[model samples]
Target chain A: MDLRVRELIKKIRTDKNITFLLALVAVGVFVAQIVYYVQKGEVFSLKRGFQALFLSVTLFLLFAVLQRITKTGKPFDKTIVTLLRVMAVVVIVGGVLPSCVEVFVVVIRGGIYTIDIANLDIFVPVLGVMIGIFSEIFSYGNDLQEDNDMIA
Target chain B: MAIIVRLDRMMADRKISLNELAERVGMSNVNLSNLKTGKMKGIRFETLDSICDVLDCQPGDILEHQ
Candidate 1:
C-alpha cells in the first residue's frame, strides 16, 4: 500500500493496453503468415518456425504486460521461459534452414556452393521469441521482489 | 494475513440488514457474507471504497489486521 507502489501499479494498468495490442498484432501477423502461405503458396523461409518464434516472443510480452496490469509484480509462470528455448530452436530451423537448403541446391546444380547467407530472413519469429523471453524474465524479477517482501 | 473484516459490525452500528447492504451493493447476500468473513482472497478497490463510503468508515473500520 505504499503510495509510490500504488501509483506505479496504476500507471502499469494504464499502459497495459498498448502491450496487449502489440501482442495481439504479433500473433495476428503470425497467423496471417501461416494462412497466406498455406492458401497462396506465399511461403516465408520457414513459415512454421518463424511463427513459432513470433508467437513465443509476443506471448512473453503479453505476460510482462499482465504482471504490470495485475500489480502482481512478477512473471506469473515458468512455462513461458521454457517456451523461449523452444522458440529459439524453431527460429534457427525456420529462417536459416531454408537459406542453407537454397545454397546447397545451387551448389548441386553447378559449381562451388556460394556462401550466400545474405538472403537469410533474420527478422522472423525466432528473434521475436528472444524478445518475449527477455520480457518474461524482466517481469519475473518484479514478482521475485514481491515474493521476498511477502516472505519477510 | 489474518485481516478480520468487521462488515457485520458496521451493519449493526447502522442498523442495516445484511440483505439491505447486499442489495445496495448489487451482490449476492452469500457472496457478501463470504467477503465479510474474509473467505475471499481479493476485493476490487472499487468495491472496497464503495462499501467503506456507504458504511461511513475507513477500510480499517470494516477490516483490520488481526
Candidate 2:
C-alpha cells in the first residue's frame, strides 16, 4: 500500500480505539447509575433506564462497526451494514418509547391525555432515519467494493 | 457465471509461473490466483491487457464463454 493509505488506516485505527474506549466508559456509567438507584431504594424509572441501556448498546454497535473497518481497512461490509441498521432501529425505538410509556401510564391512571408538542423530541428519530439512509448508501458502496475486488 | 477464465492454461502454455506472471503484470499473487481459478466476478480491461501482454497471447487464450 502507499504510505498515505497506510497513514490513513493508522489514523482510523486510533480513532476507532478512542471510540471503543468511550463506549466502555458509557457502559460503566450505565452500571453506576443502576447501582446508585439500587442503593437509594428508589424505583428506577423504566424509561430513563431503557434509554441509557439503548444508548450504551448503540455505542457498542458503533464500536463494533469501527473495529470491523479497522480490521479490513474497508468501511463497506455486510456485517457493518447490518450493525448500522440495528443501531438506527434502536435509536428510533429508544427515542419514541419514553413518550409512549408516559402516555400509557397517564391513560391507566384515568387522566386526560394530551400530546405536548413542545416536549416532543423530533431530533432523535430524525437522526435514526438519517442513519438508516447512511446504511443504505453503505450497502450500495459494498456492492461496488465487491465488484472492484473481483476485478483484481 | 457463463464466462470462464483459462488463465492457468495460458500460463502453462507460456511456461510462466504464477509469481512471475503476477510480478510482470503488476498484480498480486492472490489476485492472479483468484483470476486463474475463475473465482473472480469480472476482469478489468487494464488487467486483461497486462495479462495478455505478459503471456504474449490473445484475450481469447485466457477467457472462454461456457
Candidate 3:
C-alpha cells in the first residue's frame, strides 16, 4: 500500500475505539433521559421507552462490531460489510422511525398535542449512515487488496 | 480473473508434486493451490520469481492472458 492509504487505514483503526466509546456514552444519556422524565412526573410511554432502550443498545453493539472489525484487520469481509448495512437499517428503523412517529402523533392529534425534537434524534441516525458508508469504503478496499495480492 | 494460470500444467510436465513445488518455492500449500487453480486475484513478483526459479520455467510458461 502507498503511504497515504496506509495512513487512512491507521486513522480508521484508531477512530473506531472512539466511536465505540461515544456509543457507550449514548447509552448513559438515554438512561438519564428516562430518569429525568420519571423525576418530572412525566408520562414516559412504555412504547417510546422500549424504543429508546433498543436504539441505545443497537448503537452500542454497532460500534462494538466496528471495533472488532478493525481488530480483525479485515474490514472488507463481506459478512462485516453486511452487518454494517444491517445496523444502518436498524438505526433507521429503531432510531429514526420512532422520532418520526412521535412527530406524526402530535400532527394527527391536532394543535393540542406537541412533541419536542432534540438534536440527538437527528444526530444518531446520521452517524449510522456515516458508519455505513465507512464500512462500504472498507469493503472496496478489501477488494483492491485482494486484486493486488492475486495479480502477481 | 480473465488471465489464466498454467502453473499446474508446468508442474505436471516437470513431474513435481504440489507439496514439493510449494516447499521449493517457499509458499504455503494453500496459496500455491490458489495460484494453480486460478483462485488468486494477484501474485507477488517475488513469489513469481521463486516459482520460476524452482520450476526452471519462464513467467510466460506459467501464466497467460486469456
Which candidate's DockQ is highest?
Answer: 2
Angstrom error at residue A122, model 2: 1.4
Q: Which of the predicted structures, 1 or 3, would earn the higher DockQ when compared with the native?
A: 3
What is the interface root-mean-square deviation of candidate 1? 9.1
Which model scores highest in lDDT? 2
lDDT of 3 by residue, A1-152 (tens): 45665666688766777766766676666677667656763334423654666566676666666665556655567667767777777765676665565555556656344445453557667877886797788689878866766653
User: What residue pairs clash in candidate 3, if any at all?
Assistant: A149-B42, A150-B41, A150-B42, A150-B43, A151-B41, A151-B42, A151-B43, A152-B42, A152-B43
- Residue runs of model 2 more than 4 Å from their true location after superposition: A1-5, A32-47, A101-114, B1-4, B64-66
Q: Model 3 misses residue B11 by how many Å?
A: 2.5
Candidate 3 overall Cα lDDT vs. reference?
0.72
lDDT string, candidate 2, B1-66, tens digits: 888899888888989999999999999999999988888888899999999999999999888998
Q: CA lDDT of B42 in candidate 1?
A: 61
Q: How accurate is candidate 2 locally (lDDT)?
A: 0.82
Compute DockQ for each candidate against the true complex.
Answer: 0.04, 0.79, 0.53
Q: Model 1: how far is B32 from its true place, Å? A: 4.7
Q: Candidate 1: where are CA atoms >4 Å away?
A: A1-92, A103-112, A117-120, A125-127, A130-152, B8-23, B26-34, B39-46, B56-58
Query: Could you estimate the TM-score for every candidate?
Result: 0.40, 0.80, 0.62
lDDT agreement with native, every candidate:
0.62, 0.82, 0.72
When only the first chain is scored, the TM-scores of the models are 0.48, 0.80, 0.56
Clashes of each: 6, 0, 9
